[model samples]
Target: MTMRICALLATMMLLVGCATDDPDITVKHRVPHGSTVAVVMFQDCGIPNQADCAGSGAAAGSIFIRILSQKPGLHVASLPRPVAASAPLTDDAAVAYANKKGYRYVINGEVQDYYRTGHLALHSDRVAMSVRVLSVKDGQVLVTYTYQEDSKTHFASPDDMLEDMAKQLATSIVVEPKKQRQGDFMFYKGNGG
Candidate 1:
């Protein structure tokens, strides 16, 4: 019985070691609280030969807008919908639009790849996307985030992955409050200053 338990534990450890690492999600900049943001249309950069596998850029942008709106300290603006095959707005144009709309930041994204593989009960969905945050004041890109995920599940869909990506992006942008100084002295009106 002891040998059997040790063997099982060793197998479990081997299996755990074989598991792949989670996808890397990076946030290059910090967005302060109470900032107004506009989410522009995402550009599709999927392979030309795999047009059918490509997802809608507009849909991705919409997902980001929806998720970012729910994040505390962010005010999302109502922006125009993106059309398929239409090129993303130039930086100048985007900055101009954001200025006109009173938004401090503009978000743009690109769907680098979107596809699924396998059939029946065996399938995996993959999504690769990049998001950028630009400042309206100077048209400078403040931060860029990129994520790629391949989820193997029987019932998972592309939309689900996209929503998850949006949630991840939203969570990455939230800025935590600065820690207070531990050595600072406290004063009260009734006590000596």
Candidate 2:
């Protein structure tokens, strides 16, 4: 009996030791403070019906921007609306617009497999969301993040569905801050002139 109890305690300690409070598991580009960012509404690459998620995508980007914006010197621009013209904001266009808006960096993504439910045949229902980001200037792929949540809801409303998706959207996108420019800062400083 004492041996069994000791084994159980050891197992519990091992589990506790493995636990972590670190929120961000993925590391992507990290932008520093005073850096401006413009986010384009993420496109839904999964299903046609889920394609036009500008409203929800914008909301999701807002959540992501909110967290990144919290960095002491960062300033984020409102996400750009999807343009119906020509090619839906070409990479060059996105960069130009962001620069025009005085943003030093920008965030744009593609979202897919996004869905929500109030109830499942089982006791718990699940929400799923996925997205990928691309860096326009260097054509560097940033990160792809996916999230799902399961919970019990007595009744699901449109708001409830949206809220769950937004929650997952916010938590899963754990982008690291871009590295600060290392060598001598060679750029001219704006003096409100």
- lDDT by residue (19-59, candidate 1, tens digit) is 54444555566678778789877776557676534446776
- Per-residue error for 89 in candidate 1, Å, reads 3.6
TM-score of 1: 0.70
Alpha-carbon RMSD, candidate 2: 11.1
Q: Model 2, clash count?
A: 6
User: Where does candidate 1 have its weakest 10-residue lDDT segment?
Assistant: 17-26
Report backbone clashes per prediction: 0, 6
Give the C-alpha miss distance for residue 51 in model 2, angstroms: 9.7
lDDT value, residue 67 of candidate 2: 57
lDDT, model 1:
0.70
- State how far residue 80 of model 2 sits from its true place (Å): 2.1
Tens digits of per-residue lDDT, candidate 2, 23-98, equal 2224375443355656766543344564334354555556656655554565556766556311245556665666
Q: For model 2, what is the error of residue 107's alpha carbon versus the real structure, in angstroms, after optimal superposition? A: 0.1
lDDT against the true structure, per candidate, is 0.70, 0.50
Q: What RMSD does model 1 have?
A: 5.1
Top-lDDT candidate index: 1
